[model samples]
Target: MAVYTVAQVKINDGERYEKYRERFGAVLQQYDGRLVAADDNPVVQEGQWSYEKIVILEFADLDAFNAFADSESYREIAAHRHAGADSLILVAKGR
Candidate 1:
Protein backbone atom coordinates (compact mmCIF):
# COMPACT_ATOMS: atom_id res chain seq x y z
CA MET A 1 0.00 0.00 0.00
CA ALA A 2 1.08 3.53 -0.55
CA VAL A 3 2.02 5.77 2.37
CA TYR A 4 2.02 9.45 2.94
CA THR A 5 4.19 11.66 5.07
CA VAL A 6 2.55 14.86 6.28
CA ALA A 7 4.58 17.60 7.78
CA GLN A 8 3.49 20.83 9.40
CA VAL A 9 6.35 23.19 10.07
CA LYS A 10 6.92 26.51 11.71
CA ILE A 11 10.13 27.96 10.33
CA ASN A 12 12.51 29.87 12.58
CA ASP A 13 14.99 30.73 9.85
CA GLY A 14 13.94 31.13 6.25
CA GLU A 15 17.44 30.83 4.83
CA ARG A 16 18.17 27.62 6.67
CA TYR A 17 14.75 26.19 5.83
CA GLU A 18 15.38 26.92 2.16
CA LYS A 19 18.59 24.97 2.37
CA TYR A 20 16.68 21.96 3.67
CA ARG A 21 13.99 22.31 1.01
CA GLU A 22 16.50 22.57 -1.80
CA ARG A 23 18.26 19.38 -0.80
CA PHE A 24 15.18 17.34 0.04
CA GLY A 25 14.02 16.54 -3.49
CA ALA A 26 17.21 14.77 -4.45
CA VAL A 27 17.09 12.58 -1.37
CA LEU A 28 13.39 11.85 -1.81
CA GLN A 29 13.80 10.88 -5.45
CA GLN A 30 16.34 8.24 -4.54
CA TYR A 31 13.66 6.45 -2.51
CA ASP A 32 10.88 6.83 -5.10
CA GLY A 33 9.12 9.43 -3.00
CA ARG A 34 7.23 12.30 -4.56
CA LEU A 35 6.25 15.65 -3.24
CA VAL A 36 2.48 15.78 -3.30
CA ALA A 37 1.88 19.19 -1.87
CA ALA A 38 3.73 22.05 -0.23
CA ASP A 39 2.14 25.26 0.92
CA ASP A 40 3.21 28.20 2.98
CA ASN A 41 -0.27 29.70 3.22
CA PRO A 42 -2.69 26.85 3.43
CA VAL A 43 -6.41 27.35 3.21
CA VAL A 44 -8.03 26.04 6.38
CA GLN A 45 -11.65 25.17 5.79
CA GLU A 46 -12.41 24.22 9.40
CA GLY A 47 -10.17 24.09 12.47
CA GLN A 48 -7.29 26.34 13.29
CA TRP A 49 -3.86 25.75 11.80
CA SER A 50 -0.93 26.89 13.88
CA TYR A 51 1.86 25.93 11.54
CA GLU A 52 3.42 28.19 8.95
CA LYS A 53 3.97 25.57 6.28
CA ILE A 54 2.71 22.15 5.23
CA VAL A 55 4.43 19.49 3.11
CA ILE A 56 2.94 16.22 1.94
CA LEU A 57 5.02 13.37 0.49
CA GLU A 58 3.85 10.17 -1.13
CA PHE A 59 5.87 6.97 -1.20
CA ALA A 60 5.50 3.62 -2.95
CA ASP A 61 4.84 1.82 0.33
CA LEU A 62 5.42 1.85 4.06
CA ASP A 63 8.71 0.08 3.70
CA ALA A 64 9.94 2.48 1.05
CA PHE A 65 8.95 5.39 3.20
CA ASN A 66 10.65 3.87 6.22
CA ALA A 67 13.77 3.15 4.28
CA PHE A 68 13.95 6.72 3.14
CA ALA A 69 13.20 8.20 6.53
CA ASP A 70 15.45 5.89 8.48
CA SER A 71 18.46 6.03 6.18
CA GLU A 72 21.66 7.52 7.57
CA SER A 73 21.98 9.87 4.62
CA TYR A 74 18.52 11.25 5.13
CA ARG A 75 19.11 11.60 8.84
CA GLU A 76 22.13 13.74 8.16
CA ILE A 77 20.16 15.94 5.77
CA ALA A 78 17.20 16.11 8.11
CA ALA A 79 19.34 17.85 10.66
CA HIS A 80 19.01 21.02 8.60
CA ARG A 81 15.25 20.79 8.79
CA HIS A 82 15.32 20.10 12.51
CA ALA A 83 17.52 23.07 13.15
CA GLY A 84 15.52 25.39 10.90
CA ALA A 85 12.01 24.66 12.02
CA ASP A 86 9.68 23.18 14.61
CA SER A 87 7.62 20.53 12.90
CA LEU A 88 4.96 17.89 13.35
CA ILE A 89 5.55 14.97 10.99
CA LEU A 90 3.24 11.99 10.65
CA VAL A 91 2.91 8.96 8.46
CA ALA A 92 -0.41 7.61 7.22
CA LYS A 93 -1.23 4.47 5.31
CA GLY A 94 -3.09 5.40 2.18
CA ARG A 95 -6.42 3.88 1.36
Candidate 2:
Protein backbone atom coordinates (compact mmCIF):
# COMPACT_ATOMS: atom_id res chain seq x y z
CA MET A 1 0.00 0.00 0.00
CA ALA A 2 0.99 3.57 -0.61
CA VAL A 3 1.54 6.15 2.11
CA TYR A 4 0.91 9.85 2.32
CA THR A 5 2.09 12.72 4.41
CA VAL A 6 -0.33 15.56 4.97
CA ALA A 7 0.94 18.82 6.33
CA GLN A 8 -0.68 22.04 7.42
CA VAL A 9 1.59 25.00 7.88
CA LYS A 10 1.36 28.62 8.90
CA ILE A 11 4.45 30.48 7.76
CA ASN A 12 5.77 33.30 9.97
CA ASP A 13 8.75 34.26 7.86
CA GLY A 14 8.07 34.14 4.16
CA GLU A 15 11.64 34.71 3.02
CA ARG A 16 13.10 32.05 5.25
CA TYR A 17 10.26 29.71 4.46
CA GLU A 18 11.09 29.94 0.78
CA LYS A 19 14.49 28.48 1.46
CA TYR A 20 12.88 25.61 3.32
CA ARG A 21 10.54 25.09 0.38
CA GLU A 22 13.40 24.85 -2.08
CA ARG A 23 15.26 22.39 0.11
CA PHE A 24 12.16 20.33 0.78
CA GLY A 25 11.48 19.96 -2.92
CA ALA A 26 14.96 18.60 -3.40
CA VAL A 27 14.44 16.08 -0.61
CA LEU A 28 11.16 14.94 -2.10
CA GLN A 29 12.73 14.46 -5.50
CA GLN A 30 15.56 12.46 -4.04
CA TYR A 31 13.09 10.06 -2.42
CA ASP A 32 10.99 9.76 -5.57
CA GLY A 33 8.06 11.46 -3.88
CA ARG A 34 5.02 12.65 -5.78
CA LEU A 35 3.25 15.73 -4.60
CA VAL A 36 -0.46 15.21 -4.69
CA ALA A 37 -1.39 18.60 -3.33
CA ALA A 38 0.50 21.76 -2.45
CA ASP A 39 -1.55 24.89 -2.07
CA ASP A 40 -1.88 27.99 0.07
CA ASN A 41 -5.49 28.79 -0.62
CA PRO A 42 -7.82 26.72 1.48
CA VAL A 43 -11.54 27.24 2.00
CA VAL A 44 -12.83 26.66 5.52
CA GLN A 45 -15.87 24.79 4.32
CA GLU A 46 -16.43 22.30 7.10
CA GLY A 47 -14.04 22.59 9.98
CA GLN A 48 -12.51 25.00 12.42
CA TRP A 49 -9.11 24.39 10.87
CA SER A 50 -7.49 27.61 9.73
CA TYR A 51 -4.22 26.89 8.04
CA GLU A 52 -2.01 29.00 5.79
CA LYS A 53 -0.85 26.16 3.60
CA ILE A 54 -1.78 22.55 2.95
CA VAL A 55 0.53 19.94 1.46
CA ILE A 56 0.09 16.29 0.59
CA LEU A 57 2.94 14.05 -0.48
CA GLU A 58 2.56 10.49 -1.70
CA PHE A 59 5.21 7.78 -1.55
CA ALA A 60 5.49 4.20 -2.68
CA ASP A 61 4.79 2.82 0.81
CA LEU A 62 5.24 3.40 4.52
CA ASP A 63 8.92 2.47 4.35
CA ALA A 64 9.58 4.92 1.55
CA PHE A 65 7.76 7.64 3.42
CA ASN A 66 9.86 6.93 6.51
CA ALA A 67 13.09 7.03 4.52
CA PHE A 68 12.28 10.49 3.26
CA ALA A 69 10.81 11.95 6.43
CA ASP A 70 13.60 10.64 8.63
CA SER A 71 16.44 11.55 6.27
CA GLU A 72 19.05 14.08 7.29
CA SER A 73 18.20 16.31 4.34
CA TYR A 74 14.62 16.62 5.52
CA ARG A 75 15.63 17.16 9.12
CA GLU A 76 17.90 20.03 8.16
CA ILE A 77 15.18 21.80 6.23
CA ALA A 78 12.64 20.88 8.88
CA ALA A 79 14.60 22.85 11.44
CA HIS A 80 14.33 25.91 9.22
CA ARG A 81 10.64 25.33 8.82
CA HIS A 82 10.24 25.00 12.58
CA ALA A 83 11.86 28.36 13.00
CA GLY A 84 9.90 29.96 10.16
CA ALA A 85 6.46 28.50 10.67
CA ASP A 86 4.06 26.38 12.64
CA SER A 87 3.74 22.98 10.98
CA LEU A 88 1.42 20.07 11.64
CA ILE A 89 2.29 16.83 9.84
CA LEU A 90 0.34 13.61 9.65
CA VAL A 91 1.25 10.38 7.95
CA ALA A 92 -1.27 7.83 6.77
CA LYS A 93 -1.22 4.55 4.95
CA GLY A 94 -3.37 4.66 1.82
CA ARG A 95 -6.14 2.15 1.44
Candidate 3:
Protein backbone atom coordinates (compact mmCIF):
# COMPACT_ATOMS: atom_id res chain seq x y z
CA MET A 1 0.00 0.00 0.00
CA ALA A 2 1.06 3.56 -0.61
CA VAL A 3 1.69 5.81 2.34
CA TYR A 4 1.41 9.54 2.80
CA THR A 5 2.74 11.86 5.44
CA VAL A 6 1.11 15.12 6.38
CA ALA A 7 2.64 17.65 8.70
CA GLN A 8 1.41 20.85 10.29
CA VAL A 9 4.30 23.03 11.37
CA LYS A 10 4.86 26.18 13.32
CA ILE A 11 8.37 27.53 13.00
CA ASN A 12 10.33 29.02 15.88
CA ASP A 13 13.81 29.28 14.36
CA GLY A 14 13.95 29.92 10.65
CA GLU A 15 17.65 29.26 10.31
CA ARG A 16 17.62 25.72 11.63
CA TYR A 17 14.45 24.78 9.76
CA GLU A 18 16.11 26.11 6.63
CA LYS A 19 19.06 23.84 7.29
CA TYR A 20 16.70 20.87 7.34
CA ARG A 21 15.03 22.02 4.12
CA GLU A 22 18.35 22.48 2.35
CA ARG A 23 19.44 18.93 3.00
CA PHE A 24 16.01 17.30 2.67
CA GLY A 25 15.91 16.83 -1.08
CA ALA A 26 19.26 15.11 -1.23
CA VAL A 27 18.40 12.75 1.56
CA LEU A 28 14.93 12.06 0.17
CA GLN A 29 16.50 11.05 -3.11
CA GLN A 30 18.02 8.12 -1.30
CA TYR A 31 14.58 6.64 -0.58
CA ASP A 32 11.29 5.80 -2.27
CA GLY A 33 9.61 8.99 -1.21
CA ARG A 34 8.54 12.20 -2.90
CA LEU A 35 7.55 15.62 -1.72
CA VAL A 36 3.93 16.13 -2.74
CA ALA A 37 3.00 19.52 -1.43
CA ALA A 38 4.28 22.29 0.81
CA ASP A 39 2.45 25.46 1.71
CA ASP A 40 3.61 28.25 3.96
CA ASN A 41 0.35 30.11 3.71
CA PRO A 42 -2.73 28.06 3.23
CA VAL A 43 -6.29 29.31 3.43
CA VAL A 44 -8.21 27.61 6.19
CA GLN A 45 -11.65 26.43 5.12
CA GLU A 46 -13.02 26.21 8.61
CA GLY A 47 -12.00 26.16 12.28
CA GLN A 48 -8.85 27.72 13.68
CA TRP A 49 -5.43 26.81 12.30
CA SER A 50 -2.31 28.01 14.02
CA TYR A 51 0.36 26.34 11.96
CA GLU A 52 2.51 28.36 9.59
CA LYS A 53 3.05 25.59 7.11
CA ILE A 54 1.58 22.34 5.86
CA VAL A 55 3.64 19.68 4.13
CA ILE A 56 2.68 16.45 2.43
CA LEU A 57 4.77 13.54 1.22
CA GLU A 58 4.11 10.32 -0.64
CA PHE A 59 5.97 7.05 -0.34
CA ALA A 60 5.76 3.79 -2.25
CA ASP A 61 4.82 1.92 0.91
CA LEU A 62 5.06 1.85 4.69
CA ASP A 63 8.48 0.27 4.58
CA ALA A 64 9.65 2.91 2.14
CA PHE A 65 8.34 5.62 4.41
CA ASN A 66 10.07 4.05 7.38
CA ALA A 67 13.30 3.68 5.44
CA PHE A 68 13.37 7.40 4.96
CA ALA A 69 11.87 8.50 8.27
CA ASP A 70 13.97 6.13 10.37
CA SER A 71 17.27 6.54 8.59
CA GLU A 72 20.25 7.94 10.48
CA SER A 73 20.61 10.64 7.85
CA TYR A 74 17.03 11.81 8.36
CA ARG A 75 17.40 11.73 12.12
CA GLU A 76 20.45 13.97 11.91
CA ILE A 77 18.61 16.58 9.89
CA ALA A 78 15.37 16.17 11.83
CA ALA A 79 17.18 17.37 14.93
CA HIS A 80 17.34 20.77 13.28
CA ARG A 81 13.64 20.68 12.53
CA HIS A 82 12.91 19.61 16.07
CA ALA A 83 14.87 22.52 17.45
CA GLY A 84 13.45 25.01 14.97
CA ALA A 85 9.77 24.20 14.88
CA ASP A 86 6.82 22.41 16.45
CA SER A 87 5.31 19.87 14.10
CA LEU A 88 2.39 17.46 14.13
CA ILE A 89 2.85 14.63 11.70
CA LEU A 90 0.36 12.00 10.52
CA VAL A 91 0.84 8.95 8.40
CA ALA A 92 -2.05 7.70 6.27
CA LYS A 93 -2.34 4.65 4.14
CA GLY A 94 -3.54 5.28 0.62
CA ARG A 95 -5.73 2.91 -1.28
Q: Which is superior by lDDT, 2 or 3?
A: 3
Write down the worst ten-residue block by lDDT for model 3.
Answer: 25-34
Q: Put the candidates in TM-score order, highest first.
A: 3, 1, 2
lDDT of 1 by residue, 4-95 (tens): 99999999988888888888989999999999999999898899888988999999899999999998879987888998999999999999
Q: Which residue pairs overlap in candidate 2's backbone?
A: none
* By lDDT: ranked, best first: 3, 1, 2
Total backbone collisions for each predicted model: 0, 0, 0
Q: Global lDDT of each model?
A: 0.92, 0.90, 0.95
TM-score result, candidate 1:
0.95
Model 2 quality (TM-score): 0.94
Better of 2 and 3 by TM-score: 3
Candidate 2 residue-wise lDDT, 45-67, digit = tens:
88698678999999999989889
Q: In model 1, which residue pairs have backbone atoms overlapping below 3 Å?
A: none
lDDT of 3 by residue, 36-63 (tens): 9999998899999889899999999999
